[model samples]
Target: MAPPSVLISGAGPTGLILALVLLQNGVSVRIIEKELKHRIGSRGSGVQPRTLELYNILGILPDIQKEGAPIATMAKYNPGEIEPSPSPKLPSGSSPPQTYRTYPNGLSISQERHEEILRDQLQKLSCSVELGSELRSFEQFSDHVVAKIVKTNADGKQVEESTNFHWLVGVDGARSIVHKQLGLSFLGETQEEHIALGDIAVEGVDPRFWHMWHVPPKLLVLRSSSSTSKVFMFAYTGRPEHLAENPPTREEFIEEFYDVTGRRDITFGPATWMSNWRPNLRMVDTMRSGRVFIAGGSPFMSPSRPSLNTHVPDATHCHSPTGGQGLNSSVQDAANLGGKLALVHKGLAPVALLDTYSEERIRVIAHMLKVTTELYHKMFSGAGPADPSAWKRGSDLNMLGVNYCGSLIVFEDAAGAGVSSDAYSRAAGSTVQAAYCAPDASGLVRAGSADAPTTLFAVFHVSMHTMLLFGGDAGAHAPVATVLGRFPEAAVRTVLVIPQGQTAADDGALFSAVLEDQAGHAYAGYGLTAGELAVVVVRPNGVVGAVVSNARGIERYFQKVLV
Candidate 1:
């Protein structure tokens, strides 16, 4: 049978990731962007730890590390002050035990650079974004979606194209044409306050820190990615009517900057990008309609960064970038949806699996809107964190705690059915639940091969479920393997996690791969004793699908999707 095809709107990080992941799973994908060229800005700069884990699976961690930097200290300045208040340090402790947390901190990189990396990864799969191509409209039939696209030529001519796709995903930003066409209501309110925002070259200011000037009813901020660049992102809040009545000019912006900073030493350079924005909190009640779906900021798109004063003036801002959850949430939305779609396309799972994408993601987005919007209110209410005390970025902001415990696809064996959803009660640093990111345990080596050491993360694949059998002794792995042997090897892979002294040779042909946990970290991380017999089923999206004590449990878990 011909592979199922998917059409994705928007070439931002969310769309790019969805396309790449689908392609990796042998699904055909065509992605388009409305922009004439790639966008430029440092809008969503925070890459949370959960997102970093996803990047690792995509094999783009090296690129992310090269281009991204950690969040710098925030330097607070009161209006008319020369010397800035002492910057506060980020809350620090060693990462939650190495077994549970691999990337404990978030990284900061401009949205433009982040998209460039995603595009590069997508290109490796022999696909590229179609620039100047817009999804004008699409009709969803019971079996397929017919989409009409408009493209602009270099000669300033327009061409129309139409295609049929088994699935259509809208990762387009706020005010998404796809969402509007699908009749999804973006339910939320728009704040009255507006913010003036721009990226510009500046003189005589250090870029090593994020600078903020606090004034009543207005907050000014200047930040740069690195010290070597003269370009900094500048923003200050105001009333919506004020900007409409007296549209800002270059001179006016410079005057406002001086007035807010109270420093004559700093000079403004040419503006690279500038706009005024009003924040809006909005979301769709449902993310999918038949074969047409919306995701990220709204359903799976990055929250309207432009509307929140990131890129464009007239846009939707369902979420503020205060906690840096905007981009991270968007990436996760794509990741979650992509995993389900890949399985359905490959025929390993029924189409019903796709329904869980909205079920799981809507909850996450709801929680995110609450946290980020609260931060926005705090900042605008003059009750935000002050100097000598930074906005404490806690574990919640890192996104490690995001889980889908209530997801329809997730199941728990009888023994694990009562494992509370609290992180404290679960294994160290984890919430004992099915729909959480599986912890990574290091000091793992293949049995008897003596190859380079590996970690649990090294074994994760984005396209299939991983079944780990706790083979405490030489004879405990066979039954687990027998149950896994029933499934297609490509859809469900079986691995035996054995103690250091165990060998694959002991298991004969029942188990093909044996992972030796040298320091017993894998056992401890999974909350197992030295000789406990258990099996863990990790879903394609990195959620722990089930933890069971025997073959019956494994059969029950696979029955959910694999017939």
Candidate 2:
């Protein structure tokens, strides 16, 4: 009956997902949006594999897979050329089937539909976005935030209300009030190029391929929309002054489309949404200012203690829409902060855990900006679409390689062999390292039941940390049980994993569940040999919290994370 502890500004994917995570963890949340109605557009449509894994953890992967389509092959048309050349197969679009991954392909779904799915999930959780309600301003106190909210009434009048919450998060886009009020330095450069983007129906283009054209100093792309037939997401890059002076009208977009592509056969329809975007590559020096945080297109916030307040803002960082990392990164920002916020709110973890959100995200965001900026330059460098390097996307863009290695909170008792120094490069050789994205291993059958095989991802929960004991026998149970007894049973789920050819241990009384690695996929995925004793703690957010050798290491790792 009491008011929600968290106030989230901007009901976009970031805020909605953050609220979902908090609510799932039994943390109350109030989410608000400045927009009177949900916007319509196919913006930021690329859903990377890493994001799909996160969606799986949130119990929305089924919906996403149902509603989304695979990334379309690009059909490139050079200047004065009518016949299109298809882009070479690239690893960025999808990964081949592997035992260590579930969702290997990148998905293409409209941002509108993505947010709609997230909103639906929030509704099921007994929460809804307060539309037309804006966070006008907020003053952060030591323990709470006093926010001034402006609501637009049906009569077109604005009413102001003052409320207090334990935490405030801004998911409001680049011009976030939370970021402005917090006075964080948005350090980066604005590129000279400008782009016009919109969603429009087209009559003549093939729906199977993403059409692109390159004329010197001008580039245009029309990607098939996944959710709507005959509708395409349009993007045109041109001179800054030209795009700025000319608004994205239907007629103007149509004319530009023909002029750039040299295709008069395509008939353009009314645009559903349009925007003139400039590449503003910027990020906050710090994601938190006392009780305020920014995220989404910007920064975010969190509380340090039960008595303290926190703020998270949307638009903490904004970059070029090159690698499709905008929406994906923003959602990740929420995922990272949500678990910490929930723990802090419940008095289960110290407020210091909240600091790890900024620490982990800032490093990733900085690298992300650099990668996207490079990709942007490659796309518009006046090289024809035939330049393989310009169009070829590496596996890094999938975001499965993103990790929080070297984070203060993550503990690795021994160095992982063959781990890459550049943690953001690729997911292939980094599974055993702490702070990496947790790997998925199939062919895991429940103890004493091999009728239906399962996966490690299938048993992972959203609100609990999973401790995987690899190759543990009956003798190992006593020490593991003693260490687990020190923590709240509900907060951690212990699972004993038996390798192939080994007998299952009677650990039902000690562990929450037991899994048999029927095909050695579990051991292989974790970089362990058969019968090797190991402890791997997977955080609720699907990150490897620790890679330890014994029960003592497990205690040492959790001591830094939990209260």
Candidate 3:
């Protein structure tokens, strides 16, 4: 077969997710990791609600839900207190059922398990991560990238190989070779404080709430990772000079825990993984250099520097892990780029479409850095642990409100002109708007069938744009159909959403599917009323790209996105 179109360096969640999305779109991909084996530990364990929605479209939500646990509530203990004191509930904790959202709460699955699920999905597509294979260097041409890769053989001998691909993406963590070789500037501040994190076995702690104890200038948190096993994720901030070990010894961790909580009964076990995390508040000025790109592990921005372009990494952009946005933001970066890259590689969209990746992500990442940094300050602001506001996670962190409102590619008709462009300002409310995460609605029954009721989410495909024509007159369908016919059938899927008890004259042959909004959820989720006619285009990444009133609107929207 011909060479894969994309070469992805680093098989972490970002690379794996990008590879999966590209493969699903029929774009060939090769993913490599410098590590000989998969990394373990519950790093970035919080999978926010927005990420869960994306996972649903990727067809892995079931596995994630099955393997992951809900975000636990905090059980705060004051100094010398054994029993927990009432603590402020995190925004990620349990909540009332949401009418517009399918997955309303954050999940607690370790990064290792998250990657396992993604790798399994990719394996089903006949692709696998090449472990011990590292992207040593790469040179980008106008149309292709030549990369030198070093692979460690079974006997541990290293072999060098040179290959070419249409594009190269660096998801290789903070120290991204791609970002460096591309000459991108990662500008940010390195915080003075340090945090120690580890996954260790602990006995006598309840495996329910996230246990925490505050001893002024120092705080210790032990969050349960398993109900049956004794493993818990431990995080320590403000380590004293005497106990300042890089990877704290088991005895040191135990001593700190005992000193903070005064729990002499609690015993400690061996630690599986440990790290001394120093916050680096940085981001890249650019995210792309011709055919080469980067995502995840680094923080990135659009071009402001002359030398280069930029991920969720220290390479492109990196910040404190306060709101669990690093991994999820990295995944979002991949999701936003994968579809556009696939379309461009397949010659279905203009190469300029790829530029929007950096444009769209830079804003979101900037706001994310601000929010997470604020949370970091609040957590360590000399405020006692009992200060509920210190631990409070707002709904904005859920990322559902994250939007590409002012994106050059997204189009909002006059009907949606009232929708806010400021995602950060209106993040807490549920308002459907253009260039935002596509909301899910259940209780849709396919036309002319008695099959089990489905959902707007159930019909969304990762490989194509889903054009939902909401409550349009019969004549309106033909013009939209004609416009959509200009695009590849595989690239766009058309669905007709009608009000409950409405019957169409045809079997929806002009559309790929006809969904009867049995419970009015389809209209409600899209902020439309029954009998209202509008066209909503959900992009391959599950973002609402356009909210228009007619076929001309659909045409205008795609013109901005496709070739």
Candidate 4:
């Protein structure tokens, strides 16, 4: 039998990034897009820090950075020295101090340029893109999906083609054909909400202009990616009544632009792109069912930015022109989904691990929608005192801020109980801290303590009959993989072995290089090192349950936590 194959629809950054991630796991992928050619939509101009990290992983940032222009680190108005707000939300009375992180690895590249890079990467993979192809519909079964695709002809005629897929993902946009066919609920408002969009070119200038707004309705932005520069303008008016019957035209757009900006200096250059869109945000109630999954705007959603008044995930996967977060968020989504699928592909992790994708995304996007929607209402619509105060409560983009505070989320026995990272201004040692730790190097962050330099990798619960290896070497730092893999099923299993100087690949006998003889220590079989790589298993409440090699002994440790 052949290995599982997947059909990914849509070549937007989100779908493209997702395809790259899944392919890393040796899954068969075929990306089908309706466009026979590459087109850069003006949406999703900002790539967030997390998304940049993803590009770094793909080994394509140097190329992206080379092809794209650099973005200013600050949100500044032209001819004005930009002062940072405490955050999107600040204290009511006084101005909070201005601060910026430069996102360490964040960037602002045009949506088109980002897509170009992704397309290049996709070409390198075994799976190639199918242009002029549209997903007419699909049928899901226990093992695979049978999809009907439409092939457009030179005469604009459509012909139907049939194909089978082991798994399918709908990374298609909001008007997803797959979304409609799946009967998945895209619960949210759907109406033409606002009218105002444009692409402009500016000359003879300084480099760093992230975005700018005059006051009230006049919002303009300068963003770049892949050798292209774009400027957009927006207005706070009801959807064009005519759009309901027909698409908005350039003549109509000219009027809306003039009315909102109160100026005619802005004229459409070559009109690279244009759109009349509503600010409605919708998401699928579920991301997956059987062998199918949904991504991008089709499955996950958040409130769209209307003028600089909303929170959106950074621009890795998708970015809207509003807060410039659409692309960043989309890219991050791709990166995150990429990491999870990558690990799953390696078989180093379980299939159940894929379940976390929807769980984490729902929380992140929902909070973004709630907070950003409120920001729009306050900044554009009048801000009631209560609204501003409530919104102020959550302004920082802490990695730990978006928690899996939902139901399907269950603690991994190692998760500490109820320890909110926000409560402490200081760590257990009383030092100010920042950042959370995530399991595995995929960069799919999880809520961890203020622990510094936390070990970042996966811990496998292997069967007692298994032989373990770490970093391809045993006895190296953190050389042992599972100190507990060999323990009786009920006992705490902790494997922390780092070869003092040996690797499994280099040695004929892998276990001897850094195998733990912890049967004598307090941790008994707990994996540890006085000043070396270690793996220690603890109870969900943060009590030490097992370690590699401790002095006290392992028997009492299990007695304390296990029964």
**Candidate number achieving the greatest TM-score relative to the actual structure:** 3
Residue by residue across 1-563, what tens digits does model 4's lDDT show? 65337788878777887787666545667888876676544455555444543455455667766665444432433323344333232211211112111123334565666778788887888666778899988888866689889988667888898888777777775456666766677555543445344344434223354343334333333443323453432232444455423234556656654564444544554444444444555555767666677776421133342222221221112212333344545555555455545444444445565676676565566555554455545544443222334334332332222233321322222234323433211112211111111111221111221223221222222111111222222344222333333344422333333333322244333232233222212111122233443334432111122322322233333332222
**On residues 325-412, what C-alpha lDDT tens digit does candidate 3 reach at each position?**
8888888999999989988888888999989999988888888888888887788785746567777777778887788877888887
Model 2 per-residue lDDT tens digits across residues 502-560: 66545566878778888788887777765557888999899989888788889888888
Error at 472, model 1, angstroms: 3.9
The per-model lDDT (C-alpha) reads: 0.73, 0.78, 0.79, 0.45
- Cα deviation of 408, candidate 1, in Å: 1.3
lDDT of residue 54 for candidate 1: 86
- TM-score per candidate, chains pooled: 0.91, 0.92, 0.93, 0.64
Superposed Cα RMSD, model 2: 5.5
Backbone clash count for every predicted candidate, in the order shown: 9, 31, 19, 48
Q: For model 2, where is the 10-residue window of minimal lDDT?
A: 301-310
lDDT string for model 1 (1-563, tens) is: 54339999888777888887788788889898877778777766778888888888767888998888777777787777767777565443235653467888888787778889899888899899998898988888988888899999667689998888999998875566776787777777777666776677888878777888876655778888554567887777753354532336667778877876788888887776666566777767888778887777721223223331334411222677677777788788888889888887778888887888888788778777877777777667656555222365566677776877666777776445533344212233333346667888889988777688898878888888888877455556667777778888778877888877766665745665678899787887776655667788887767788878788888887777774
Question: How many residue-pair clashes does candidate 4 contain?
Answer: 48
lDDT of 1: 0.73
Ranking the candidates on lDDT from highest down gives: 3, 2, 1, 4
Residue runs of model 3 more than 4 Å from their true location after superposition: 93-99, 298-315, 415-421, 425-431
lDDT of 4: 0.45
Off by over 4 Å in 4: 1-4, 68-70, 73-105, 190-192, 202-207, 210-268, 298-324, 335-351, 383-395, 398-563
Ranking by TM-score: 3, 2, 1, 4
lDDT of 3: 0.79
